[model samples]
Target: MIDDAIRVLAGDCTVIAEDADRSEYRGRVTTIVKPDNTVLVHDIDGYQPVAWLTRADSVSSDRTGDFTLVAKKDTQTLRIAAHDQDGFAHYPTSAAGTPVGDCPDCGGALVRSSGVTCVSCGDRYGVPADATIRDDQCDCDCGLPKMRVERGLAFNVCLDRACESLDAAVKQAFDREWGCPEPDCDGDLRILRRGGLIAGCEHYPDCEVGFAVPAGVVDGECACGLPTFETGSGIRCLDATCDRALEGALETEPTADD
Candidate 1:
């Protein structure tokens, strides 16, 4: 199964499948290449993949302007052929952009190869397209670039682990919106790692507050004077305690055009 977090490269192509029983199936299909090198051929209408090849399966490609990808596993074989010279477009996991910083693991410069991956260690850090990387250092005394991923969420991250700004930034970002939920503790909640959705408290030893972040939460604010996450259901408050408040606001609020 493909993890929700894993991005896929997809395109339209022709697929030919040969089974061990000597049966053959051929059709036009949408091909999705996963990060793990697994290939899935799906029908145009459905989400299910009609044919697939595991990463362990032997794969070979032949290109003559256009390209043909062949995968074989035991007696089963799958072939995907591109009709046009540029029938398929290669969508990289990372967009073309400037380097963020030096790799913390290897000290080599970090480039956006596949979402801010390290050139030396190949460690991938997810930076959304709109993520801001400024030339100036943050106020936290880390002297590292200030990176804000989600716009409405004020969380800024310092990619360098040696810098002490990350915890401080997190504390400031979530201070007014949501503090550490731990009882009798006042530590601020913040994101401990870059490209991750988990938020932990600054007071790790004393108050270990953590939670899974919902999608589309930004550093910006809503009319409710709290940070919000744009979920599929609707806008929701970052504080779980304010769920009922958000629901009530959504029910009463009217949409206005700018």
Candidate 2:
């Protein structure tokens, strides 16, 4: 209880007279870090950091950058600490930018990938040309979520709420980079990484031409023990592995926006 009194600073005190904690530890507020919720108190003791101080704002302190007072060994001492609103300075969580939250169009689940593009669509999230804007009134009262994805990912925001958009995006990139190179319909082929060089024509059933694959995000395994690539042509076959990949291939249905 006494310690709480010191930390909370119950009374209005004047100057930080003596030392209850670090005797020779007195310094000015140097730099502050919000990521780790720490502060550097600069003084003759060099720049020592005080970490994990909560509610440092509730009370006054000799140190700046927001602080509280503490008493040690019956003497008043200043301690750099955390305040209620300091979360933004030392927070670890990342927020989705406009248009990057739940899709305003459908309220479908959206994620802010840390990389250069949306993990689902592989589209560059930050570029305006790479995406389109809509006056979304569906949910988020504010408007479209902001785009934060960097440009290094070499993709554009599908902004598509359905898994179909994701699948299409992946296929578009893959085909652009590694065309089937087959004659007649080489460009429209689907690359399947089953166990070896697995690929087949997107125009399936009528023109069946399957290959082997070595490794990739598998769609599913056929009854014949062969893995297949899942497409948006509707559910025709239920390859076990393909089912899993298909789940990822589509966007999760979103709920209310905002």
Candidate 3:
């Protein structure tokens, strides 16, 4: 996750914005320095910012006495000098989204921003791309939110990997359960995570047989001796391109795009 802290300086500040033309703004304004170094100077006049610089390549601040913040991007620059600094602070922030639960480490609001994140403490939990954050909290001592993930079956597991690992659950349920579909390879399909969940050959480097676990539940066995997953697209073989499943299984009409 990127930095979730935002620097704020509010007071009677003189703002200088340089772009296609030079302009200066002076008032009791609020200067917001975003996590990505974007600077926004907002006055009491309107909802729109008086002056701003987009995500800058460089940002420098001097708070010796009167606070000074300068952000530069390409050829544009936004400078703020607070002559009478009223308040200056760095606040932990997160995107406003559906609240999952409260953070166990810090009593902060946990939200779905990129992943499950603590709005106050900045603690983050990686969730499966297809998983849904459930309202039902985990029973474990960690007190993290449970996520509904579908690998073979719908699994309700804790978001924190240390408390309840999704990989370990899947591995316990399905590891070495399938035989390798590769010709003459006496290897068992093993559950593993390499960026994403995958069922790879136990003989990894030698066999090089790996298939990404689709976001679906296992419905039946494929003619190719692999699992047939009931996915959003319909029924599909674990090996996406298995011709045997296509030949024997019921075919669904291609979904029309809206």
Candidate 2 accuracy as lDDT: 0.35
lDDT of candidate 2 over 1-258, digit per residue (tens) = 011111121122122323433323233333333222222333335445432232233333344544454423223334443342222222223334443444443444445444223323334333333333333322334333332211112333333333223334444545433333335554445755344223565666655655542223334433333334333343323222333443433334445991
Off by over 4 Å in 1: 1-17, 20-114, 118-130, 135-146, 150-156, 161-168, 172-235, 239-243, 247-258
What overall lDDT, based on C-alpha atoms, would model 1 receive against the true structure?
0.58
Clashing pairs in 1: 151-219, 152-218, 152-219, 152-220, 153-218, 153-219, 153-220, 154-219
Writing each residue's lDDT as its tens digit, candidate 1 over 1-258 gives 112222232344577777754434445555666556677877666777887877626767666656778878777788877664334545434333567776545676667544666555555555545556665555665444666655234556664544534446544555444566566878766655545545667787677666555545563344444456775566766654554465555455555952
Which candidate do you rate higher for TM-score, 1 or 3?
Answer: 3
Model 3 deviation from native, Cα RMSD in Å: 6.2
Instruction: State the number of backbone clashes in model 3.
Output: 0
Q: lDDT per model, in order?
A: 0.58, 0.35, 0.86
Could you tell me every candidate's TM-score relative to the true structure?
0.38, 0.23, 0.75
- Highest-lDDT candidate: 3
TM-score rank, highest first?
Answer: 3, 1, 2
Clashes of each: 8, 31, 0
Ranking by lDDT: 3, 1, 2
**RMSD (Å) of each candidate, 1 decimal:** 11.4, 17.6, 6.2
